[model samples]
Target: MFCQLNKTKKRWRSMFTVVLTCPKEQEKCKLPPEVCWHIGASISNGSWLSQFLSVFLTDLKIDQIVTFLPLPPRALPLQELVDELYNFRDCYFETHGVEEAGRKQSDVAKEIEKTLKKLEEKEDHFKHKAEFLLQKGRCLNVAPDFSAVAEECLSRAVKLEPGLVDGWNTLGEQYWKKGDLIGAKNCFTGALQQSKNKVSLRNLSMVLRQLPAADSAAHAKQVMESVDMARQAVQLDVTDGTSWYILGNANVSLFFSCGQNPQLSQQALSAYAQSEKVDRAASCYPELHFNRSTLFQYEEMFSSALGGYSRAAELDPGWEEPLEREKQLLEYLRKVTELLQNKGKVKARRLRTMLSNLSTSALGPCSSPEFRSPTGRVGSLEPRTLSSLTQGHNAGVAALGKVVFSLASEGRMAFTFGMVDSEETCIVVMVYNTADSWGVLIGDSVVIPEPQVKRNSITHKDESFDFRSIRVDSPLLLIVNGKKQNVQSQLAASVSYKPLSE
Candidate 1:
């Protein structure tokens, strides 16, 4: 005899029909009334019937019938489930844009929380529970408003698994987001103690750069340390764009905080280029674009600076900083353009009189006549016209110009003004780290020694500009009206650290 089984499901109910055929008769055979069984209820509740059929068919030597029976589903391992959830979270984050990522993260966080709740019932899944908590915490950390819960979850995770480096790093990030620099620093340091990983190293490098230092020397030391740590992180993972980006930021800090080293700026740009090349996602990072824009602005690349700011704003629509920066840059350019347009209004007699009256005699003790020549020999250095100064750093050259128009201060750090040199060449002068007390008025004789010059031309939107400018890092470097600016007129450098990304 041969047996055949047919099954069907509707709603929650399942029906199974079995037929037995006799080869000799070539017809279906009915089981004895005592042997017949009828099972009813939902498929989930029909386990007993399934088990009975398996044994009953095997006993009758009907193996083909037994093969059709359904087996109970096996439970997935907790570790595997956790891994899948993490993968799902990461894939969702990557696929969504930054603006939409927050909402998506909330959905992912709910799934992770559900998993965590299930894990709580299984005492053996302690490790998996900690991992879930870490994942959940990281997800929530992306949105600043969720920081409180994120911190709680991260804290619990670290408490459960003290050696979890990622937990520590996420906690550090949480602290950093909340502006608790000391707490963030400690968390990153703790993560480093566990292992010298790229994430912790790069984060530590960023924190180090922002840490408060007692003096300029101490600040320089911290900045150099930041650079060293960032370099180590890059060495640890050459392909990690985040590390390269952090290294770029550290170099930028070194350039601005320490002496304005052009080489350091170049190094920063190179690092950023490497980051962009290695990581396709670097373009989505607003911080990278914003920082690069700041550097471009410093380098006198106005068009590139504007584009960078615009890109950064596009990447992070809610962030107003890039927009504010773009506005300030446009305003500065407009003011400069207006000043340039009215350059012809100043009479030749007044210009000549101002140029002739420009004297360094008032510089007195602040004047440095001896400059190191190209051969490294100290010699009498003669002042050159602004037009004669070469691009980049004019190391041994000096220039004298009269301030013709004072522009509005950009941020609280720099005072910008238009200047006309002795040769009738007009230029822009930016004196950084100056106090409001050091008034930079129009027609004031300004003597700059060892001026750093950048010849820039910007054609942005409806405005076009072509000019050469001098950047003086400190007011002490300027001799105004024959009197050298004292340290009292210099503003102490303020610390405003940028986030790793937006």
Candidate 2:
């Protein structure tokens, strides 16, 4: 116990006692790392004892890492160690090139045979055996895994070197791809326990996301927890694009499970866009676009969804998910177009953005130049809002009140809510006419780049939390306040949209 007994200070209200263990009888209660290092090196006592010394020093170094302690001499740097591990993983992955599942099963088998034969000539090394199994597992003709053999080899490799972080992570992934969620979960947990790292944490969070849910609410809770882990991983290492993608994926899951949370949906979309910006593989990443496209499809943004799905299909022709979604969305697109073309019953349909001075629809006071209109932010629906969405305006209004992104309940439209401080790091959804980035999408479609709403030449009022909505009905005439500007999205006969006005 550490005490201030000799001091004139008050009797110790609290004391912290630290105890450390030693392998052998030590005369001193505490030993410096240098002394430990020298003693360890001397006792191991052979030219080949460098290995044991390295092991000891490495453990000591790792233990001190969170404390931000400097490394003792003759110990490996953590980053250098991580680099070496990654180099080994990359070398193995690159050596085989991309494995084509159905076509190259025999070739992969042959490659395994060659590797096994070469290994027979040497003293069977753990890394060599592990590498053989890794190649075999990765090359297996089944989807994304080698079945039992790959798992067996990978499991053995980690057994051979329990400290090998990469092997544990890879094995965990293999298990996950094979649908052994519990097995995958355990492996990732083991990896994190052994080595707390961004890759392992990110993987663990994804595995958590995939775990089977007991019920709807249970799944939502799980997704929220998983999202927290994913966000933590991203914060730990922003450079890792995979972490960002995982974060987006978790948010998307939460968006669905938690009664279709619009805020979560927005987070999912933003995270995805950020992932695309940073991830080089996004160009040909089928899963990335497919997931993103799926979001668009749910939003009834058909044109955007179609583009995403098409690009995903082009990237991986074998993937079925994109093809299926594309087919469904195409039908939706046709229906939307036909509905727009034959709208005899409806009064009118358009995203009615009326200025105060407009004759037909005047949302704000013409006298006051400081009022900003409420803007709609798009959100994807799962089972909710789609029925009314597919139907016409009244159905839309009825469904709009129940929409996942419905700001009407909050007394305004979507995109109307933002931080009071505009410059702060926060979500911003502005008017289509004034926002630099905005687009229009009919049901299940966004036509390439929707025509830009001509920028408002007038300045806007200062931001406020005070929100109010007014009822205005007008045919979109593209004329306001005796001035005209070009709007990219037009109200044609076929376009399907209900004005967000009561």
Top lDDT hit: 1
The residue ranges of model 2 lying beyond 4 angstroms of the native Cα positions read: 1-143, 343-502
The Cα error of candidate 1 at residue 265, in Å, is 1.8
Candidates' C-alpha lDDT: 0.73, 0.45
Pairs clashing within candidate 1: 362-482, 363-482
| lDDT per residue as tens, model 1, 1-502 | 4344433335325444553433443334464322322231222345766665565567667444222122344344555556566556544536776567436646676877776666555645553567767766765564444378779978999999999999999999999888888999999999999999998888889888877889889988998999999999999989988889889988988888876678999999999999988877776677889988888877667899988998887666667888889888988887776776665357778888877877656334334445444335465446787768899877665677788887764653467877887678888788877777776877788877777888777876677778777888788877788776788888754435555452
